[model samples]
Target: MMRWLITGGCGFMGSNFIRYWLKNHTEDYILNLDKLTYAGNPDNLKMIENHPHYRFVLGDITDPQAIESLVPEFDGIINFAAETHVDRSIAQPRDFILTDMVGTYNLLEAARFHQKKLIQISTDEVYGNCPSGQNTEQAPLLPGNPYSASKGGADLLCLAYHQTYKVDVMITRSCNCYGPYQYPEKLIPLFITNLLEGKKLPLYGDGSCIREWIYIQDYCSALDIVIQKGKTGEIYNISTGEGIPNLEVTRLILQEMGMSEDLIEMVDDRQGHDRRYSLDASQIRQLGWNPEYLFSMGLKETLQWYRHNENWWRKIKSGEYQQYYRQQYAQRHKKSTLER
Candidate 1:
């Protein structure tokens, strides 16, 4: 059985990947290492916590010694650990640089020393805005925000390790992912959870900024394919090619929740927010991978999940979430109210 170490396995995409891996690749063994940041909710993988082939390690990738000790135990490493939220990055770029870039460097070193294959989970934002056409893996890196810049730096480090040390490494840059267990800080879940809590949805700017959406399950499937079949030292883009405007997405969520557009409260635009992001996922598709859920169907499924798991998110939104929400939106709310 192939043994793998999956970093950041408590976060949204990472946890989904763990569940997907355990379910589909029954013969493989997994070791999940996570620092359990605010977004890394253990409850996301509570269902499989006791599985025989799965193990969880509380640790940080930024610690070289920690990574060194674990590197020898696993045949491969899939790094999903990152400071992902754009707003959080803007507010605290230091954490983003330290985690996304420096942490990745430590992992790369461990992987190189152990001669283990490495897979870097990345985002399409590294290409900045694609106003005209979809970006291929060959596109130049032009990260707009601190979060994307950090990730871009990490991606470059991974490729450099492969080229310089012959360390087996592959990278997959994917579009926005949404589904169950996602932390509510992101747009879709934020809107869904806010509506559930009798709060208004915070719509940014004119809400014309566009993003491609991929269901979490489909994203996990694509990652699985890459881990098993992808060649080392290559980069792949994973996308469904479904670009939708932020306002339109918020409206869809409102519609799904049977709420009114009147609930939307337009807020100040985010700093350095990319206009649009698109990815040419044809490369990964060529490796016998395709998304199973359309945006509409996936979104409906997501809404249903939130409806059924109200208690799960309700508890989260009660404490720290309240403080974060106020800090992020209070000023924008004031401005919006004045304009109205």
Candidate 2:
């Protein structure tokens, strides 16, 4: 049996991967390690909590003792632990730098000591705003925000570790992921939950910015391939290859729910918003890992998940979300008012 460690296994992407891997890899076992932050909920993994092939440990990646002690217990490690919200990174750059960059360093050092095959799960934001041309694995990073910058730093850290210690490392920079179990703070979930609740939906900067979204399950599939067959010291881009404008996606979503554009509230745009993020993931595609979800089909399924899981989101929306969300959804929103 293949024993593995999954950091941030309860996060949106992590949980998706964990669920898929556990169900599909009957002979494999996983140990989920998570800090259970505001965005990470243990409820995501409740279904498989009792599975013989799965176990969980609550821990932070920054804790040296914890990471070192557990590094040797697994055949592979996928790091999904990150402070991922861009808007929050603007207000709390230090925190983003801490978890995304510093925390990765902790994981890398521990993995090196244990000679573990480490897959550093990263974001396309590390490549910064993609220019007119499609970005490949070699694109030079030009991150604009603390969030992207931190992820970029972490990518470089992985490269450094590979160069210095010769640690077996595989880095995967995936585009946006949306699917079940995602916290309601992200775009698809946030607006879906708001639209369901009859609250005004906030769009950042006319919502014209574009991003390529890979369904969470497809991303999990890609990661699974990378873990099992990827070469060490290689970078793989995982994306749908087409960037969709935020407004178009939002409008489509609202239209699907029988809502109108009139329900949208035009708030201020986000600071340093990247106009577009596109990736050329042909490298992964050529490796026999093709994505299986279409935009409309994936979106419909994701929308339906939120629709079906109202209780899961309603609980989150009633607290901090009640206060910070409407404005945080758009960078143009002034916190001074939300604070009141």
Candidate 3:
């Protein structure tokens, strides 16, 4: 029975992964380390808190002492810790650098010294705007904003460690993921929760920017395979290749919720927002993996999740997120019709 450490385990994707891992790998044990940041809600994994094979530790990856003490216990590490939100990153770039870059450095050092495998979770935003064909794993990183820049910096550090120190590390860069237990700060969850509460949906920059989406389960399954079979010092991209414009997704969400189009508020676009992002998942597919859920099936499941879990998201949106929301989107004025 292998024991693993999953950092940032209380956040949306990380929490979902813990549930997925423990359910499928009954013999394996997971120790979850989280700082309990704003997006890291303990409620996400409330059902599995008492699982015999799972344990939670309240800690930060930024602290070298904490990571050094823990890395030796686990056979390997899967790092999900980061300052993820783009809006928040724009307002506080230093935090993103500190966690996404420096925190990753600490984990790398610990893993290097302990001779353990490290799986770094990354994102497609590192490629910035992809106005044309799909980008392969070898595509150059041209991160536009502070959030993507920080992530890109971490990815580079992982590669450097693998090359210079012979650290057993692999990186996975995934497209946008949507599913249950996602904090409302993200696009899909924010729109879903807002529609549920009869609030206006903020559509940025006429909502034309395109992005690929993948179900959380599909990503978890892909990651599981990566952990078991991925090559050391290699990078993989996980995606559904299902690209759609933000406006279309907003309209689809409105249609699914039986809400009027009037609920869409055309707000000013984010600074340096990429026009599109798409990845060719040929490498992962060659590893005998493929996505199961289409956007329609995933969207239905996601909507149902938020529909029933009102109390979970309501508590988050009503707390510190409210103040940040006001600072981020509340100040954005509706774009003039002439600009459209």
Per-model TM-score on C-alpha atoms = 0.93, 0.93, 0.94
lDDT of each: 0.89, 0.85, 0.90
Q: Count backbone clashes in candidate 3.
A: 0
Model 2 misplaced regions, further than 4 Å: 320-340
Candidate 2, 1-340: lDDT as tens digits: 7888888887899988888998888998888877767887767877987787887777788788878877777887889999999999999898788888888999899888888888899989888887687889999988989999999999999998999999999999999999898888899998999999999889998888999999998998898888777889999999988589999988989889999899888899999999999999988887889889988889899998998988778867787543564224323321211010
Tens-digit lDDT track for model 1 on 292-323? 99999999999999999987787577765444
Model 2 scores a TM of 0.93
Question: Cα miss at 65, model 1 (Å)?
Answer: 0.6
Please give the RMSD to the true structure for each candidate, in Å. 8.9, 7.8, 9.1
For model 3, residues 4-65, the per-residue Cα lDDT tens digits are 89999888899999999998999998888887677777678779867878877777899999
